[model samples]
Target: MIRAWKRFAAYVLISLAILVGMDMARADAGSTVAPAAGPGDAARSWAGHIAALRARA
Candidate 1:
């Protein structure tokens, strides 16, 4: 009935909000952990490595 549908909608909205929040958190954390610029390619390589590690976790 209408009541059940309303409950279902609320659950879906809450789940979506949680997912978005987690994604935003990950992005924020990654930005903070990013390596700084260097003279050569080493910094870029390290950044990619760190990103890969994060994705795995």
Candidate 2:
């Protein structure tokens, strides 16, 4: 009774999770969003900040 209900709930939750994941994958597959930054952009940005701090000090 209680155990059977728990098992059923788990299966239902798992099935819903699988369906949601599949839907998300399909949506992302059609996305055209571009990358936010190019290679070395983070490093360049960090170096710029460090240079500014040194100049301030």
Candidate 2 regions with alpha-carbon error over 4 angstroms: 31-57
Overall lDDT per candidate, in order of appearance: 0.66, 0.61
Model 2, range 1-57, lDDT digits (tens) per residue? 999999999999999997665445434445333333966865654455455445545
Error of 2 at 48 (Å): 44
Q: Which candidate has the top score in lDDT?
A: 1
Give per-residue lDDT, candidate 2, residue 41. Answer: 66
